[model samples]
Target chain A: MSTSRELTRCKTFIPGFDLISNGGLPAGRTTLVSGGPGSAKTILAAQFLAEGIRNASQPGCFVTFEEQPADIRRNLASFGWNIEKWEDENKWIFVDGSLHPKDEPVMVGDYDLGGLMARVNHAVRTINAQRVSLDSIGAMLVQFGMPVVIRRELYRVAWQLREMDVTSIITAEHTGQAEAPVEEYVADNVIILRNTLEEEKRRRTLEILKFRGASHLKGEFPFTISEDSGIILLPLSSIELRQKSSDKRITSGISELDAMCGGGFYRDSVVLVSGATGTGKTLTATQFLAALGEDERGLLFAFEESRDQLYRNALGWGVDFPSLEAAGRLRIVSEYPEVAAPEDHLLRIKKQIEDFQPTRTAVDSLSALERISTVRTFREFVLALTSYLKDKQIAGVFTSTTPSLLGGSTVTEAHISSVTDSIILLRYVEAFGEMRRGITVLKMRGSQHDRNIREYSIDSGGMHIGEPFRGISGILSGQFTHSTSSELQTLHRMFENDDEES
Target chain B: MCKDFLGNHVMLEIIDVLQRPDEAENEKILATPTLIRQSPGPARRLVGDLGEPDRLIQLLGLQDHIRPRQ
Candidate 1:
């Protein structure tokens, strides 16, 4: 009879990579890092090995098939990594695995990887290396033409590394066409790096395609390669850590809009208010914030308007900004389009979220966020921000301006529609020879809401949602085409006549 | 109607009963998660997940008396 015993798995909390990976790379296994030229494949591999040596105090070996030891040492020295010092301390080993000049060519029948295996074994045995990185398996693949021989050699290398309890990272250059060969199947993990040109700008991305013996997050994580940090992987998923809070309602000060949002905004729901320019989008958002009173904290990130101008316009709407500011419940951050990047805006909002911990947040127009990058990047930015808000359980209101009031449902503000939990569309409708406002709830996930277009108006007292149009067609198109049915017209006249007689 | 150990009054009032006796014989009779206001005036029921205390109070017409905990 065999007794079941629990095995404890060791985890490394690598500084930059750990957070994105949920922890460090899986230990005691093989991880394949594949990418094209200038895709940071070598840098990423070195990051894993260097991080292990520095942070975890685990010795690692770097086996290079392309670069010489002197060049590799010199290149890494610029990144502030003292490879010689670590080598002298016996904590690191850099082995040159390139093809030698005097090495004799072998026949197809008796191909041998015994020499390469012996070198790897020696490095592991001498340094007690816990991590081993083969820099360019592509070069090795070119040298060994036969698939069967290459596969056998790789399998043997992986088996020996496993037996010696070494976590190996094997890197290969992707041909920018098909997937890498045999590595995904033979190795325990596979990570693919891609550099795509979006809107004439280059965007670098990293994706963990496969990881055996463990459950991994499946998504393309955007990353950057810099001189300061070799490779920084930004997890596509938002930070999920948030403090739980009691549920409470914050009013929009507009009674009609409140009814549309199921009695104002819920504790942590994200409300996206989209409309055209000069349609009072910012005013509506400010009115919502102003209704929170002098006690509850509310923050606004305005990308279009200046802070002074926003305050003045908000003051025109009868909002008490001075009192709200004095009470420390209201804060507005104005940013210009030229000075800020999407990451800068995200980081600033993240810092504010950490500092104020506001119950409510309003981004006065996602239009600027859309202009900062391509549609995909903008989508990611919105997703990351929404994820942050959802994790915090904070009720957020995002305002965006559309190019046309009667345009198609396709929003010009990137792909923000899908990321938003609820979409409140406000547009100017032409009726009775006057332009009137109409509000409609496009979609609200996880909750039931009214789906009818309600006529709304804004004045001194704020916005008011009135009855829906009864005798109109094409309400969403702003201009309604009313049918002139003689019978209905006579019935209306009859009712008016009866009222006059009474 | 009965009282729990917390000294709060609880009830399983089925206003529209049209079924068999066995169907209603369960010890814990289930109803919609609704808050029935019977204190100030005419009774009213507010339904759905009442996660927001302030919205619940306003919906129940008890915003004047129900003070939120800071």
Candidate 2:
């Protein structure tokens, strides 16, 4: 209770959890984690102890008032926690408080829970444990059916755990549909786990409701469970925006496009190329990744096409994908967005980026993945990927397909415009009864870029940027406005200001 | 303590908690003074000081089991 010293924190070593918790749980304090059934509450509690044993060699004690210790051990073995071996090595202990049906005790007069406390204390001392988990105080209510006694005893247990100097998590069950829980005042630090269904998709999130006297990232962070790992949270807000700006330039592989982007794209920048299906958005991403340096590698995630189709398309564009991959420089992974959730897709994409350690990555057609995620989730996915690449000083190209074939702004571009360093728009321009293509650098950060809409055509060699499209207006909003004879002269005067005449 | 009430009908089994800690833990015995009516339909357990003989029988619902010593 001393306010003079800074509170210590205990890192759980759960992936992405420590970052969002601003280090970890408050040290030597009792944190009550409340969630509904099947919300992975038990898994999280066990992981707190398991990670302690695995990461730091710190022993732990589990005081369960519901499920049997054997059941917990068996259920959590998929997480690679060998509870039986830990018990044999004196690194883990379980104070089984499970109310065996045959051994159910009757409460005629009065009781104190001294026996349970004694067992818990004995187990803690047995291993010199630094962490402890009390699985669900709600079950104890069923056993005793006395709310007053349980509340008093729970407060006492919290104090006792503090005295023992162990970081602990006491899990409790709450109805998921309700917006409030009665146990908000039960503990100083509280975390809530929610598994909610939105738009027929299950989204699991972990929210730190309050951390008394400590700093933590507020709001819910999306999380996913994998077979190898129990629960992995995507701490989007934890990603710092203070990425080092790199002045170094890399080519977009298209010579005219590079000249238009003020020499070239920044080395650590994320360029979002947005266009319709036939406007060659994928071609722009492909060219960007193909411009990797001699020794540098490239990673491409193709969500719209298969491996052979991508290779064939690249070969048609005069870029040999098979030989580049043979040289150990290029790696391509293609998958449908419906195969996994947005969190899982991001995790897998990140895994590839880490494993390959590429200098550049191109996700061909980010719009393909957008269909599987909600607007908010898609924004987070793009932000996470963009920041991840920028932090590593890796250039990225994310292609997004607009909903319409003509000049139109895509939803993906609108959501991720601020996150990307540069935005390139490719549109279908219907000029003089002929459907033509045009490209323009819409926005660029910290660099002067070509602002005029220039006509471009996709050939066997790739996108070739030609002369600027004059006398055209409203090409961005999926409309064409022809200029009058007098207005065309004024447009010519504006082009004369560009100093392009030889 | 309740020997007078169930003189002939009761089969008294005394259990020392310190010596038989396993049995105490098995029964989830947290308190010292405890009484259990094992047989005669559904079993029942009454813990703590029984206070009086009538209250003990009333609490345990063993009014029929209570009889005078032969």
Candidate 3:
């Protein structure tokens, strides 16, 4: 043991989960995992047991009360958890407590789960199991109609399992009752899994409400279940904020914009470029990636466009993406947001960043990710992703779409700009009868930045930042009016204090 | 009513075999909704609905002393 606190942990090998649970579950204690249907509670319990077998060489027993043993085995086989092989080796035991009755009515108070407990005990004793999981005590509760009797039998089962000195996980279904379930009171630890509909998209979260002997993170954490990785927990609070500031700087790939951002964006800093449609957000992000040196690496996560589309579009800007890839300096990852949750997308990006070791990263637009989740969850996801990148000392460039073509206000701006280190606003300015693009440095932390709203154009030559929009007012409000030189000087003098405050 | 009639007529033990699957398997009870007359001589098994009181009483050899449903 590395420290005195390490004595009580069982160390479940699920990734990103153990850190949030202080270390792992309290050793030799029962954990209650209660959730609704399709919440992946069973998968988590199964992963706990499988990880024990594969990593710690600790034998386990799975007392299945809901699914048949063979069916469970076959279902878990899709996850590559070979239950049969482990069972055949005597290192694992599977007890089937499924009620296989044809039509027999289970009378109340008559069925005490004695038969099921006997089988579980036998299996545990045979394997000398170190871990045991009763997959859902709810199945038995339905058989024994009385809640008091079910509670008593469940407590009895939990006590018996504890007496065997094995770490146990018992699953329960959320009955939609006002009061907490009996299993929550009986177990040493309780974790709830929730699968909810938010804006017509499914969001999954895991929350550890109680741990008997260990301190844990005190809020709900988002998680996802991949076919390959059983249950991936994204404990955002587990990541420590990187407080050390970096003095180094990286280019924005466009020279004029870099000059406006006070010698490019600070190294390992997050920069947000907010704009409406057709405002060159993607082009600006790709330019940032193109600015990386031949040795330094960059990764672009294009949420809206396909890889080929980004490549073809960048070619129009006289940027050769294939050459950068050949030189091993750039990688573009395009993923469809409609298929998975935001956590899944973040996990994939984390994996790619870890493997590629990119010095700089870019998410072309966060609005697409927002479409896949609720606004609150998307903000959390963005915060975690940006913090993780900063901890790795990787400069990040993220683009967000404003709802109005005219720069009024947007949800993305209100939520994302606070988390980012710098903000650059791009808007459409109607000077006369024609529309033109204008750019401004809204905020840059830890350094001085250009406060002027400049005119910009995007064509085959990419974004060319021209001179600041002189003798013009209300450029960002979409109602542009020409002003005299004296009026421009007076206007600048009036907003000088405001610029300093901003 | 059938249970009441059986109790009034015969001295027998009624056990819900589902409470003990091992015991049920030991008795070679393969299907459910099954009634096994364990002792009066040789064991006989009757399967399906026992909702019909007269048919159940007759099948269990209790026809000699049939009671009306009160």
RMSD to the true structure for each prediction, in A, is: 31.1, 3.9, 6.5
CAPRI class assigned to model 1: incorrect
Instruction: Give the per-residue lDDT digits (tens) of candidate 3, residues A21-116.
Output: 878888877889999889988898889989899889999898776887898888888888899999998877877666555433423113355555
lDDT of 3 by residue, B1-43 (tens): 6457755556655545545555553443323445667556456
List the candidate 1 regions with Cα displacement exceeding 4 Å: A1-26, A50-59, A62-128, A138-159, A178-188, A211-221, A224-247, A253-255, A291-296, A306-312, A318-352, A371-381, A412-421, A441-473, A482-502, B1-70
Q: Is the docking of candidate 3 incorrect, acceptable, medium or high quality?
A: incorrect
* TM-scores for candidates 1 onward, in order: 0.63, 0.89, 0.81
lDDT of each: 0.68, 0.85, 0.80
For candidate 2, write residues A180-298 as lDDT tens digits: 56676657999999988877787889999999988889999999887777889999867888899999999999999988999999999999998888788878877877787877899
The better-scoring model by TM-score among 1 and 2 is: 2
For B8-68, candidate 2 gives per-residue lDDT tens digits of 6667686765556556556655444566678764767665555666777787777777666
lDDT of 1 by residue, A213-296 (tens): 555567777776545546655564645545354356667768767676666666777778888776677878888788775556
Please tell me which model should have the higher lDDT, number 2 or number 3: 2
lDDT at A195, model 3:
89
Rate residue A75 of model 2 by lDDT. 90
Ranked by DockQ, the better of candidates 1 and 3 is: 3
Model 2, docking class: acceptable
Interface RMSD, model 1, angstroms? 38.3
